[model samples]
Target: MVYPPYLQRSWQRSHNLTNAQQEALEMAVSEAERMTHILQNLLDLTRASHSMMPLQSESLILNDVVADIAEMTKKFEHRVIHLEVAPFPVRVKVDRNQLMQALSHLIGNAVKYSNADELVSLQLTQADSWAVIQVSDKGDGIPLCDQSRIFEPLYRVDPFGARSTGEAGLGLSIVKHLVESMGGKVII
Candidate 1:
């Protein structure tokens, strides 16, 4: 993701610079943040794949957790996320922190891949005794042929770096690791 250049105060504060200079500085800062994000995701992917950290699983109210996640999505993503919950509450056993990270990653991915006018939603329901949370978006989807391998670390649909972000392609892998660590499955 191209994170905002929040760290560069001079670019935001200085008014004396020429228009060309401002644009150039903003571009440079954005590029640097994107690169840094790639590197950080790479490190996180490695840690997720290699580490055998004990999962601190616990029972939690699924509705409450997803509600907090919805708020977080709106705040950080600056997008309105539609959320739906079953009439009855559902409880789930999961590692709270990992579940949050994985769901956030998936929801963020939806936002990243979709247009502002498109719909992005989180649907929560109880299937039998299981609590299910589905993150969906009306974005261009992965080719069916490549969908099977998306959870593999470093796998990218755009292998030729055709995508604008030049991402390291570790996002889904990290999400997979986090989810599976708590005995949860990712259906996408």
Candidate 2:
């Protein structure tokens, strides 16, 4: 995340620049933010794989977790994202923070890849002994060939696709690691 002070400094300086200069500065700032996001995701993947991050497992109601994530999604997405869950309670044993991170990765990807008008849905259902949380998007799905490689760190469906978003392809890898660390499996 970009620091507030940095943002403050940037905003304070932006007033002095010409229109073209200000636009350039804004683009630079966005690139820096995307780089920061990539680096953080890399660090998270490393920490998760090496057992450096602690897992604080608890018996959490699946509905509550989904609600919390839905709220966060609404805030981050700044739009009307969709949520569908069973009316009844569904409980699961997992690390709330870790699970939240994983689900956020999934939902965040949904929002990032899809268009503004498209619906990104987070659906929760209980299947036998397991609780399933599915994030579905209307974006063009990943290429068949790329699907298998997506879980690999630094792998992108189309490498040139990063030109627009500056994504370093660490999201899915971190999600996979985080979910597995909590004894839960991630399905693409």
Candidate 3:
């Protein structure tokens, strides 16, 4: 009786994986990571919606935040992020991590929906006593009918697109909650 199935004489163990097999393995890993990200977003949504975590608000410069966001995005997605910020320091009190996540989601959403050649821009400007942050992209926009509901939790404009991107549609909802938590609003 063979104690271990791998010790069978007819069984051959090849140390090398074929190119297709290797690619499949890589794809599987990518999918797994994507799923993990989705789960984390879900947790974030729950926490934000329920106020389980309080805002860790602090004074921050918008220019530095935009610069860091652009640099960080470059590592994850191959896209040009055009940043426009006020020459003067635009300071705001907010949770840095949440703000970064919100901006990153906007930029990532823009990149996902737009053509590779299309432009994506993140702009920060001081308007009156308020600091305005906007993310714009040249992409096929949501239908007017769906635009009003886009920020609702799990509301996807295109389910197929969400499927490919592995987005559970909690991004905009989280953005809304986080921004509101810091006494701000998102205007699209």
Candidate 4:
């Protein structure tokens, strides 16, 4: 789904559209693609959610996944997604695509909410028995009051705003559910 650059520029320049209008237009074309992605995620989550997803449990390199996400994020063009991987490779046991989906969701959100030039950082580290993957962004961070409920389904932080990112609000919920099902925890 391609949004014509001219339309985006015109929308961006229009005072009548407001920020929300611009966001809505950008999101409209992306909605189908995002929903497709969410559906695929839901399928993966269904397997993992029900403990039916098979875990390969091989020594997997974290750097590879981070690299893959960084490369994939390049398509966004409007955002600058960065990776701050540890100097050493961190190995873990997990399903590669599922993990990638989880990280992709994080990176996706970072890109969605952030301004074009903002930085989104993906960090990987190992501590004790757990391997940690953190994706942080410089966008208006989740509001203090809503932090607790951000993982709830259909929850939108800016539901009525024109600049709002159009999410079914299921991504993080699915991420949380899938992670816990996989014996890993998700932190916002």
Best to worst by TM-score, what's the order? 2, 3, 1, 4
Clashes of 4: 2
Q: Which 10-residue window of candidate 1 scores lowest in summed lDDT? A: 1-10
Q: Please report the candidate that would top lDDT against the real structure.
A: 2
Report the C-alpha lDDT of model 3 over 1-188, residue by residue, as the tens digit. 22234333222332366777667655655666677788888999899889986888899998999889987877778788888889999999888998998887888888988998877888889889999988888898889999899999999999777768788899999888888888888998
List TM-scores for all candidates, in order: 0.82, 0.90, 0.85, 0.72
Query: Which consecutive 10 residues in model 3 have the weakest lDDT in total?
Result: 1-10
**What residue runs in model 2 are displaced by over 4 Å at the alpha carbon?**
1-11
Two-way lDDT contest, 3 vs 4, winner = 3
Most accurate candidate by TM-score = 2
Each prediction's Cα lDDT score? 0.82, 0.87, 0.83, 0.73
Which pairs, if any, clash in model 4?
20-162, 20-163
Please count the clashing residue pairs in each candidate, in the order shown: 0, 0, 0, 2
Angstrom error of the Cα, residue 169, model 1: value is 1.5
The list of candidate 3 runs beyond 4 A from truth reads: 1-24
Residue 177, candidate 1: alpha-carbon lDDT = 85
Off by over 4 Å in 1: 1-19, 159-163
**Residue-wise C-alpha lDDT for candidate 1, range 1-188, written one tens digit per residue:** 34455636656675877898788777777778778877887877777777655678898888999999999989888888999998877888888887888888899889988997787899999887667899999988899999999998778888876247557678899899887777777887
User: Whose lDDT is higher: candidate 1's or candidate 2's?
Assistant: 2
User: How good is model 4 by TM-score?
Assistant: 0.72
